[model samples]
Target chain A: MVKGKTLTYGVLLGSICLIGAGIYRNEVNIVLKKAVNLCLECIGIG
Target chain B: MDKRILTQIIATIAMNGNIKGFFEGSIFKGNSKKLCVPGLNCYSCPGALGSCPIGSLQAVIGSIKYNFSFYIIGFMSLMGILFGRLICGWICPFGFIQDLLYKIPLPKIKVNKKANNYLKYLKYVILLVFVILLPMFLVNDVGMSDPYFCKYICPAGTLEGGIPLVLMNESLRDTIGFLFAWKITLLIITIIFSILIYRPFCRYICPLGAFYSLFNPISFYQFKVDKNQCTMCNSCSKKCKMNIEVYKNPNSMECIRCGDCAQICPTKAITKNFSTKNL
Candidate 1:
């Protein structure tokens, strides 16, 4: 019974995080792109 | 069969983009743009399907143009309240690796009981000084980078995330210098020590784990002590890899919700439930 509950919560939380990732995909990409660009800049590549 | 082994296999497949590859034309690029996972897996890792929360936090915090990241914080809070350190035990790929490493033959060191109390606080210090405050304060106009943890400390970023990516990309290999070599060295050291020590990263440094731990006692999923059924056998503590005295406080910051104690308990005393208190 407890195992079932734990599994359910895990699945629910995992799905929420995944869905949130889907929704925020562009923003996250923009930020990472910028960060990577900055890293390249720091290394004198950009 | 060990449940952790099953979890590890599943997580590895999920992380490797096997699941995501089914939906997307290519696994490598599709998941790279997503939000970070709660654990320490790096965003740049070839196999990673999502971003790394700590890396994202550091990137945003360290950014010269941005002052704050509501997205990262909100995501972190969501994970914290929902599962607490359970994420560390169950979801984290690095944690799964550590579990496998500890299974190898070695002289396992049990940390001193008195010293253990003090050591748990180290992660909080790392979070405050290294992760948040330093990045917020240290930057000139150019902005600080990912701070001391990723650059100097995080072996997960070094191992599972760094080495494989660098090895795969020849352009990245050509670009590697002293810093890359240093990180590789740190990774090697961590892998060697992890064979004998249980989660040196989780115990000493992981800021994400530290943040989630603060919510452990009050999280939706928590350990409940029946109090009556406990036989005082100390069996639960003996089985716990996190070195927590489960009976004294099952919802301790050190408790990773691995379910080891619950499964091992002779009397079936420890259980998980929703916390009613604000603690």
Candidate 2:
């Protein structure tokens, strides 16, 4: 039980740190740039 | 209405409800696409309202930066730890489509248990090779790589986005090549196998499912079996589409947490629980 809790907390903390860094690095725009465009290559239309 | 039916409707709609994209021949260019839905819905799908986490991860990593895949990893981590493959059960567009196809009542195919169990590990191999390693190392001179899984493998993107867009736009037909043909063949095979076996892709080939399965052992929400109530009649096992022996290990990686076991347990031996206690 304690182990599961610890693992879960560890994952949560790690996620927070990553998300914080993503924001700091302006990664949301990177994701948005990809997402907003129709990925022609992905759909085999390229 | 069944919980599965209700959630399937909602998830399908949420994933592909961008009405304007259909007439405009454009994918939704919205802020929502910045957010990854916990399913395999293609961001390139004309009607898709959000990004796919796996695709996003591959794209970001392939851009040749060793920077952290923070946004997608965080989102996927939270989802994995919270409900595990419940996302596969209730939210995946392709999984829902497979369920609908399986309802067509074809003579089902069941592989022998030993082989079936061994085959489930193939998805992990796919996750490592296609989604992670290839994109990580197989770069060209420009220090960029392709999303090998998306470009070469993912039938969902081909079916959901490629076919639709090509059908809608005649110009896309000129671009058809060996890659497109291969993806089409894969989609057709997946569609056929989905009818023969329940979630064959999820069971043996889905990289996303592979990632989510990592959390099944320790996820916060899980299916619990009440050993005292179990008569070992095996009704739960029989009803399982994923072929899980639910009464034995309710939290097995093979289980999709679809509640079929709990729904079928004659003595109410299984229940969904949110507690941290071990089963």
Candidate 3:
């Protein structure tokens, strides 16, 4: 269906744009900041 | 025994390839942690090489400075559109564990269809409430919130990250408290249920699975049942671990695209197509 194709391509394009925006905003560092440390909460220590 | 299981093993090893961390009792803190793996891997796992999207999303949303994460959302969306729950079927370490557990000689319990239809919605509710709302809305005096799902619900985090870390670190054992006990209980229940059921968590608990299921109908990679070759044998439906009626709806939200249906189809009526032509 054309609708499915449109939605799929639309989402793909939107994802690329969002990724670009995230990089520009230095959001990767946010993930890094959290992941690099031992998350006691994630381990259910808290 | 199959390519899918082999792929699962390779992916599990690939994502948690920091084998040294398992021995050291410390999680990997390398630059690779910036990337998010496509499955429900815990970032806190001792050998994990990448971040978990759900946890990262919660962190960003729960932070005072931000209520959204463009990178994680984008990454998850891309994966969802491309492969949907194929990630659940093939690559997820937890999923692989469940598959292996289900292979045990224990009798499987097939949930009632009516109950299953309703229970499947619980994952969506969990995604909205625990993964999104609680983290975004409930904050401490410092304007920060907990990763609610990871703290309270995720057996993957407890099993992959918690138990190993505790077993390795004697100091951490002293900090074990009610939450840890609760998580351990949950993990035990999940393990037991996994033996009696095919992917009980994936069917009724995993928010990540719920997220990916939404894209099944429209994902670039999809299933198509050929009308010409179809015999309506219904064997595919009977064999589906997710309990999907493949011939009736090849692109059901419940289908993980494990290719079991395609493999079982006597006439090879089912095909995994790369085209996004029909929704």
Of the true contacts between chains A and B, what fraction does model 2 have?
Answer: 0.62
Using Cα atoms, each model's DockQ against the true complex is 0.10, 0.67, 0.84
**Pairs in clash, predicted candidate 1:** B36-B51
Q: Model 1, residue B103: what's the lDDT?
A: 84
> Which of the numbered candidates is closest to the native, going by highest TM-score?
3
Residues B1-279, model 1: lDDT tens digits = 778678766766676563433333222455354556667666555556666777677777777656456567767877887888988888888888888898898889887878878888899999988888877888876775545566766777666555654555457557777777677777788787788788877887789999888768667788876789998899999998888889998989888788989999999999876644323
Which numbered prediction scores highest in lDDT against the true structure? 3
**Distance from true location, Cα of B228 in model 1, Å:** 1.2
Q: Tens digit of lDDT per residue, candidate 2, span B93-145?
A: 98899988888987998877999979999999999998889888898898788
Show where candidate 3 strays beyond 4 Å: none
Root-mean-square deviation of candidate 1: 6.0
Query: Interface-residue RMSD per candidate?
Result: 7.6, 1.6, 0.9
lDDT of 2 by residue, A1-46 (tens): 7888888768767767777777676777777888897787688756
Query: Ten-residue segment with the worst summed lDDT in candidate 3 chain B?
Result: B270-279
**By summed lDDT, which 10 consecutive residues of candidate 1 chain B come out lowest?**
B18-27
Cα lDDT tens digits for candidate 3, B1-279: 689999999999999999998898999999998889999999999999999999998988888778788988899999999998899999899999999999999888998889999999999999999999998889999889999999999999999999999999999989999999999999999999999989999999998899999999889889999999999989999998888989999989888789999999999999998777766
Expressed between 0 and 1, the share of native interface contacts present in candidate 1 is 0.04
